[model samples]
Target chain A: MSFDTKENTPGTVPANGHSDTTPEARPLLIAIAGNPNAGKTTLFNALTGLRQKVANYPGVTVERKEGNWKFDPGRPAARLIDLPGLYSLDATSLDERLAREVLTGRLPGLPKPDLIIAVVDATNLERNLYLVTQLIEYNIPVVIALTMVDLAEKRDLKIDVEKLRSMLRIPVVRVRTREKTGLSEITEAVRGVILEEREADAFWIGNAGIDASQQADEIHLSLSDDEAANRQIFARYKFISDVYQASVGTFDTERANFSEKIDKILTHRFFGLLILIAILLLVFQTIFTWAALPMDLLDQGFGALGETARASMPEGILTDLVVDGIIAGVGGVLVFLPQILLLFLFISILEDTGYMARAAFLLDKLMSRVGLHGKAFLPLMSSFACAIPGIMATRTIENKRDRLATILIAPFMSCSARLPVYALMIAAFFAGQTVFGFISVGAVLMLAMYSLGIAVAIAVAFLLKKTILKSPPPPFVMELPPYRIPNLRTVIQNMLTRAWLFLKRAGTVILAISIILWALMYFPRSQAPVADESTAARVQLENSFAGRLGQTIEPVISPLGYDWKIGVAIIASFAAREVLVSTLSIIYNVGEEENEESPTLIGAIRGAHDSGGAKVWTPLTALSLMVFFVLAMQCMSTLAVVRRETNSWGWPIFMFVYMTVIAYAAAFATFQGGKLLGFS
Target chain B: MEKIKVLTLADVAAGTKAKVLRVSGSGPVPKRLMEMGIVPGVWIRVVKSAPFGDPIEVRLRGYSLAMRRNEAESIEVTE
Candidate 1:
């Protein structure tokens, strides 16, 4: 049977191969489906290196990865869509439902794929084949790409490919994606099937046991939809069992395997929780220690660039905008890249090695107590690096309420963007002080701030679960995939992709926001100029729009131990929390005649005094400000992502209000309480 | 012939093997469990329980799956 060309055209054409005009020259659409941790992504990355587009599916937070793969030279390129990894077509979660719709051509804007490449984990064939059986029911032409065959052999499980092919009546290509072997054979098989244009074999219907056929028919004829579904499911499983019996063999004892030997301690009741905490602590320590050098280099590089721009350009608004607004603002956000990259590196390794699932399993009990699934833990942990990816990672949580709760508390994890604010404040106020003789007081204060964020996040999550976002915790049925040595290429590629996305935002969104803030603080220059440059700078700032706005909000924030300058920094930081540092630098550095480097930005902040000649940034004020940063919903990008993920402004707006109120009250208490305790 | 002892998967002690007699729940949980190869006649073993004894891990079909005890309660098993 020749394939129906009209029904198989992909919605998007390959950008490089658009010149071909013949109907036979149309691109072929192939969708890859598989269970999670099956190396489907590795195969996809091998087939389409750096040529894929990752975007969200319409109206959902699930990522859509599409790329073009050329089977052979001069052959029409086939468009490959990597559908989300799912267990079955039962379609419980939004991602699974979307995968189902795309497979069946029910999702709008996506045509039915001409062929499906079902990536099956050879070691776990019995479970992976469940999805394959469901795919076979769709009657689409399927080419089975068997991955992890070597691993299966190591486990002493031998899978007879030829026997499996004859039994199932389909092509099965053994592939080792990391070594990039057997890929050409898979492509050739796909090309052969597409050219031959064969229909799905009806072997399953005829080869089924007579009893199963009779049962299926009876349910189809007389039963309701749910019963019919159950009957169909039973039939499929029976068929899978028959196929397994014929083509699969095992030689090892059915006892504890290597993974279990490791899991004995990893998943132990007491040790597992301790190990989890230790691992998280190690991750945090690495993020801070490893990222310090690169962060300092990035900071100095931006500072030098700003200095060069100031020395080269003429004294005008353009020079100020370029040096202070664009460089400083974007640099503020970009400086966190080293930490974000390291975070994703650890996350990618954890995921690639299959420990993430075990982590989820270990955390399920604690998470369920807070009305969330264990899967929510990973996404929330990811928020400590940055909330954008953390919000995106929430798609793994199947339950809507749990996912929302995770997304809502994700920003409270004290992301790396808040690092600059805390570092600057602590250096200014708590430097040279030591706790416990050897421990730096600043470091202790930083750790305490981070702990406060986690504590508040847990409390808020509990409150949300009890009130607005209340829902029964969904059953946590997750697979703990066997561990494998993580592929370095895959982990590095993932890190690079995330870093590129972060840099892209820095160049575009953060760049624009910094320019706007700069103009707000730069404009409204007085017609009559003052003689002294520093006096002119102060006068100019007071007359500007941002300055007036900060003064207006001064009364409101004064109770929290913040003056107009801090007030202005808070307002500017709404775009990104780290902008507060750059805002203070620009506000204080203006019209300074000295060009010395030793008296750094911290010294400038420490030297500044209020109108009454009292110190503006006391230890209490600094602590209060850090607390405010830890609690406040300050990042616009996070709000935008939350809006996009939830498909509404309501949740993000509500999040902003609640977080701001909490931050205000907490900071207020710290300042007032500290004053009463004689700290000031 | 001997009568097999029936117990819900939740009541089945860790490290004990049993065959699923029936998946009794009616919603998505049972359907999902069946999809993952937890059906009648499939042999399964309780691998371990979480720290608080809510979610228990099980080994079946050459892979491991972790589910809450309440969800496991729906799976009728016989040793």
Candidate 2:
């Protein structure tokens, strides 16, 4: 019945906790709360290290991260809950609301914390204090985990922790979570607060309970009726001032403030946007260059593994299963993990360093000018990497119109899932021509497709605003946090966590799908016997369930310049996008044979032709296929995520159907247009 | 003096207010405009749209933000 048992810990238990052999004692619950990018996550990771579990909030899509950590040396089996980052207790977005809900015990089955650890960004005190003020009202024992003290000192900001602690009536400790310094002090402070069982200060409730109308009365108890109310309402600020005087110390303020000066340019109407675009372009280029080597290694490694397995086993169903089903299907999805991880790495860094909010600040005007809310930019930007997260990110946007519009246009921004499809086609059709020195024809084609997606998104957004999903624009309220040095540990931890999730999925959903596809193309227990098993195996696949399905669909796709084999590949690829490559590998009898020196995917596609003496994968089919993927929502996982995020099956189904229609129409137009031009 | 139809976010300056008259696109323009807080009844102020008209900057709800210009023309505003 206990969620707080030692079993809640994910990894190894601490050495101190291992010595405890008696019956259970009440474990102290520590809740970490902070403003976004306040190093709350860093401190959580530092405290818990690898002992954590990531789950989804019951009905909502917000990530639930929990871990176990020892507070006191005497009692090392205490529990730790890493709460979501929040700006204020008056929550607006789902993330902030979830944080508040968990803290307030509104979330079902989530326990109330015995002690609260308020992670405050030292460099940004005034803004972060808003949340601290609210948490004090909850009457919980609080220990202020002051973070980014190093940056605060460099910026000429001074903090009198002792004075502030007296004013707020809470234990306060300054720690640099990323540097692994002051951790013991933080733990000691947490232990002190928990063990002491400190009661909330009366002034905290007195200050926090005031409203705008009664502000004056709280401060001046004897003031006249209206003035008395005013004092009551303004009492909160008075309390804050008292706390500021007590706990905080002053330092020399004459030092250079790089953040403000930088923000002046970065948040500027003209210069800021140019920098953002330039950064985006650089990111796109980096994704290609940095990911290429790893991608190639993965492709070769999977091929070699399949080949080795085939060689070790005798020609039988087991060999086919290992080579084609497991290797082909699972490997197809696994190959893209590196590229996805790299993309996530950059996003995590950008977000952690406080540049993400600036990017939004720079894009607000442009979004508003287009009739979209500023909050939509985050999701749209994420869409460039992957639509699933982008769609999930729509929760951050408060306005219904803005959220819907973002969700609708997100898939239009070419995601990493579509990268494999585009890469395959561009390599096959436009091999080695360069538009400029750095930009090749293939790159140009890719850029053009991306450009087209954006253009179409804009047009679609405008049209949709006028016709459907029409609502007045909500006021754009966004918090702009000051920049701080990003914690390297936190960024790496984030990257590793995401990569682990991807690897986990590859073992389950992707593995199952891959095996099913393998069977479809591998079986009906082929009866044909021959001396040479390899040649007979190729003929047996042609008689399999997948082959029959492909043959049935061939007549429809014939004019699209695809053969029965291509048709089969397309069908099998629906489980995932990159499966197209593996499906082609299996269909072309390259499943068990690993030869990098032989014909590559592009070469095979180019050499393929139909009985009519026309090349099957002509430039037209390649173009059509690229356009199809650009417009179509082919990734079922993305749809599932969308449904989970939106909390509605309607949107996912609509997304699937509408996008598929768009894909078909676009591909049809491309093919017929090419035929009329006599290119094919 | 004549009241000009509110030009695109490109034509506006930081800290200036304009009334949204009509969004410029069929469904796409208005849909995007609505999403960005530029609906017909809402008055918008250009905070700092980006340079080269890429991500346009605007202020709403007492905050400043920037977005793409292509995203902006969809909103027809009146100053």
Candidate 3:
């Protein structure tokens, strides 16, 4: 009933500046607004240090980041809300609209900000002031945090901050976050403005743009909201130019500068695209080679821990569950952490340095052909590392239709979780074969599988854009922020945050699902005595709940060249694609009782035969299995993330059904087509 | 006196400078264009074009902006 608690109060200041309010008093909310690449995030990170929380705005996928900033011991801590960067308040995109809504008290669960710290890029004062001027019209107290003054000076332009402050009639704090200069001053300015509760002066609205003002007034009476917004936009720009002329001194336009020099080669028509492809190849190669050692160590460590648990515990259901269900299941998900970390590292660096916009610009033509924005390219590429983060990264796409389409197709990329399944199959079927003198046949096959995933994703995006998600393409206008060296602190912080999320999922959802799956395969122990341990183990598995389910589903999947055992693995893999390899290893190892060390799981699979005495996992079947894993919506975590991101079960359910249908059809075609081509 | 020729932003060649006459479109597109400082009197230079010439880069207001040709066509400019 108390929606307006003291903590949620919009702009209430204590009557006495020296009042002994508790340190736990409600913190004032300050929202930081700026254009992309204006060093706003850098300033936020610098002020908050390590006290930030990243969450989604209610009912939207745009990230809402808030941190606590305590400038002085005597003053109340201020809660800083870092809104997504936007060019203006006219709200063309969802991100821009969210900022506008939060400022105007339209968004639920968020109060109107008490003070706005408008981070303006001093180098681009004319354009950055556009948003600052718009913020003034809302009647909220505004403090301009001027940044990039060094860059402006390097360009031979000098800015008189005192003159600008007098011209705008607002407090202006020139800040250099890198040098740690003027931060305390900005904080003091914020504190002063908050205590004073000063209101913005509506100087531009009355005196400037007289003709435009008359036109806006005439149109404001009869026009709809959209037309009125249009009228206000022109007036705001006209006012910004007048402010630019009065306070800014000397235009230095003689030099080409460093950014233009870099752009010449990076945006070249032919060479630019070639460099992009080479960069992608290097990224993938690093993921495979650089992460190989860490992945192997993790795999061995998990295997050793499972073995130790099995050896120490007495033979019983509890021991089997501990070793197989819990250890194997959680380990399966954690094995890809290294690859995920590296992927995010590369992405964050690219974004911080401002190359992402250029990449999007280069790829816009091809992406538009598939009915996606160029921004979709990076998210789709990230899907190859893992789909959960990739789906979250679609926040960069502004249009709802484009974002949804990108999300729906993101899972089609072959994620790292499927690597184990592909490796197992390739080792069984394609080992020792080579195309040229040097390239291994298995490596070629792996590349082909990755290409297949990308090809299918693009084709599906093309189809979905033209049909179900059809809408006119949104205007593609984006800023290419000047290049800067990525701050090490922000990159590492992002990498760790993503890694923590993955580990937490492994600990909770994956752990519970793994335990349940163990019970399914371990229940209904055999009553009749068997001749040996291997026979007894086989009988117990066949009579278990999972075996019965696999048998029931075998008839449906036979056309895809899968047997009951393969069917069981496929069903268990619905929790995670990597579980297919672990499930198969368990099924094969349980029925073998010979030698000190168990034969490799690949050998067991190779030795498997059907009731008719033909080898079960032939080359065609292995290829078909890989195809199924590539396309299927097998990860429960991805589905859960999609549900959360879209804020509805409808899109996740639709995604699951469509992906399953496509995966089954593709596998069936591959199996039947391969058989016709005389591959056994 | 020769009449000044007014052309859309898409008609400007790379490295050429043009002063904006007006932004002509409806909906949020025009509003957004104006917000990025493509107003009646600002000068913008065509910086570069993408491989297919769909999304082109331009330098204006001391910053770089990339926009599709369709969106650029809405901005009327005089060379």
Candidate 4:
């Protein structure tokens, strides 16, 4: 019946702070609360570093992060929930409301936290403590974990801890996350107050709810809801400013701080853009260069694994199911691991170092001009690696409309999954052709596709904001946190966690559908006899269930300059876009087994002819197919993730329908118009 | 003191310091401004604008905050 006792992760504190009293009362629920960039996450990570689980709150997209706080060795670790960072509890946004609900036990299924670790920054005490004042009003025991003390000290500022403790009537523990000190004080304080019932001196703020209204009457002042809120706001500030003045001392030095100086150039109107472009280019280059080797290794490794399974196991239905269906499917899902990890690695580093906020700040104007939140920038960029993680990243945008807007347009970013399709198309048709002597035709084609995706995404985002998901422009109030050297441990841990989540969620669905597609293409065993395995394989693919489905849909897709074979590959690619390459390879007998980038695939596709002996893959047809892949919602994994993120089937289905219609229309134009212009 | 010309935060050029007169208009912007400590009498300084000249960064309460021009335009201030 315990969720805390079983998980004693390594590197936990040996907590012998106080003697055990409660045997096992369902693990004390402790909540960690603070402002954004106040080192709340650092403290939470310090307490519960590697032992954490991330899940969604019941119906909302707000992430619920929980970990174990092993404060005392004598007692089981307490459950530490990291409440969403907010400025105050005066809930204006849904995120704020959800946070308040969880804090006050108003949220069903989640008990009110037994104690709160109010992480107040030593540097930004005023804004941070404003939340603390609101927190202590709930009558829960509050322990102030003063973070960023080193930074505060470096700035020649000293915080009077004793005075602050007395003024707030709570335990103020000065903890340095960098030095790993003062965490024991936090445990001892929690134990003294919660377990030993050591109440503090009377607090400054009155108890929660209706206090200001009662205080209004105490001074014979009538109040509206707005005025009452204003009084409460001013009262909190009045007390916070008093706490700030009495508890903080500063030097008379007047020099520009290190962070401010860096911000000057990073936010410069001209140089900032150049630097941003340079950083983005470097990140994109690194993603491609670093991920290529691992991706190729995975591809070959899976091929060898399939070959081994075929050789070892008897050539029966189960072997085909295992080697052709399951192994290939699993490998396809796992192949995305490298790019996802690298993307998340860079993202976490930017987020942990606090440069993400600066990036968001720099991009906010352009984003807003298109009616998107600045937070949408990171997620949209992440879509290029894969849209599943990109969709997950959209949770940071608190506004529902904006987040949905970002999600709907994210798939237009030409994800890495579609790269094989584009490469195959370009290599088959546009190879060895160039505009001038400089840029390769293949390179130009790739750039045009990427540019097309970006352009379409921007247009779709603007339209979404102006229509279905419309609202008054979303509020873009973001904090540019002081930059820090990213902690390698935290960054790696975050990257792994995100990559793992992608695998766990998207990976499962992909495996299932991959098996289903395998079945559809495999069933009704072809009894056709041929001169060789290649001929038998090609005949089997032509008579397979998926092949029949492709022939049936020929009328619908033929106008796009696609034949029945292309139809089969396109249909198979609905489960995952990358499968188009392997699917085409199988149907064409270019290889006995599916190898996505087999150099022969290009030649096979280019030399292919229809039933009447006319060329099947003209440059125009290849271009049209690439256009369809660019605009189509071909990946079931993205739809599954969209369902989870939007928490509804409607949005995903709407996304699928609109994208398919657009993709079909655009490809139709490319083919019909090309023939009309005598290109084909 | 000589009469100081009034301006919304949007009108205050970068590198200028101004004390908030009051947060005007209704809806979530002003409410959020209050939570961020943009209430009356607290002096705030505009640090800079973003690359394309928006989302101005302001310093107050020992931290930096960035808000769009629309949000900033609502915060009436006096230099």
The C-alpha lDDT values of all candidates are 0.81, 0.67, 0.81, 0.82
A540-569 per-residue lDDT for model 2 (tens digits): 767889889999998887666667987786
Q: TM-score, chain A, per candidate?
A: 0.90, 0.84, 0.90, 0.92
Model 3 misplaced stretches (Cα beyond 4 Å): A1-25, A202-218, A222-227, A252-255, A304-322, A502-508, A528-537, A590-599
Q: What is the C-alpha lDDT profile of model 4 across B1-79, one tens digit per residue?
A: 8887789999998888899988887655677787778888888888888888888999888888999989999999998
By TM-score, the better pick of 1 and 2 is: 1
What lDDT tens digits, residue by residue, belong to model 3 across residues B3-71? 999999999999989999989867767767877888788888898899988799988878888999999
> Against the true two-chain complex, what DockQ does each candidate achieve?
0.68, 0.09, 0.72, 0.62
Worst 10 residues of 3 chain A by lDDT: A1-10
DockQ class, candidate 3 = medium
Look at candidate 2 and tell me the lDDT of residue B44.
68
Give the candidates in order of DockQ, highest first.
Answer: 3, 1, 4, 2
Leading candidate by TM-score: 4
Candidate 1 C-alpha lDDT tens digits along A23-113: 3646777899999889888999888887888776777756688998987686777889999889997767988889988887777777667
The deviation in Å at residue A317 for candidate 1 is 3.9
lDDT tens readout by residue for model 4, A1-680: 00121111111211221123342656778889888778777788888978888877898756788998888888889999988888887755566778777776668887666778889888778888888887765555689999988888888778889999888888899998878899888888988876675532323352123433344455344554454555566667777888788888552223457878997788788887788888888988999999999998998899999999999999898999998888998788788789889999999988888888888998888898889999999999999999999998887787889999999999999999988888878777777887888789999999899998898888989998888999888889988888889888778877987887888888789889988999998887898668998777788888999999999999999999999999999999998898888889888887745454567877788788887999999999999999999999998999999998888999999999999998999999999999999999
**Model 3 agreement with the true structure over A1-680: per-residue lDDT tens digits:** 01121121222332222134432456777899998778888899989988899877888767788999996578777889998898777665778889988877678987667778999999989889888877765567788999999999888778888888987778999999999898999988987886665654534342243443444446556886555655566666677766777777554432566887898998899999998889888998898899989988898888899889999999988898898789888887887899999999988888888888889999999999999999998889899899988887888787889999999999988888888788888888888888887899889888888888888888999999999999898679889888889988878877777667656644587888888887888887779888877666666667789888999999999999999999988989998987787667656754321211234777888899999998888989999999999989998888888887788999999999999999999999999999998987
After superposition, which runs of candidate 2 have C-alpha atoms over 4 Å from their true positions?
A1-25, A149-157, A178-182, A202-235, A245-256, A311-315, A369-379, A382-385, A392-395, A432-440, A463-468, A505-507, A525-538, A588-604, B1-79
What 10-residue stretch in candidate 1 chain B is worst by lDDT? B25-34
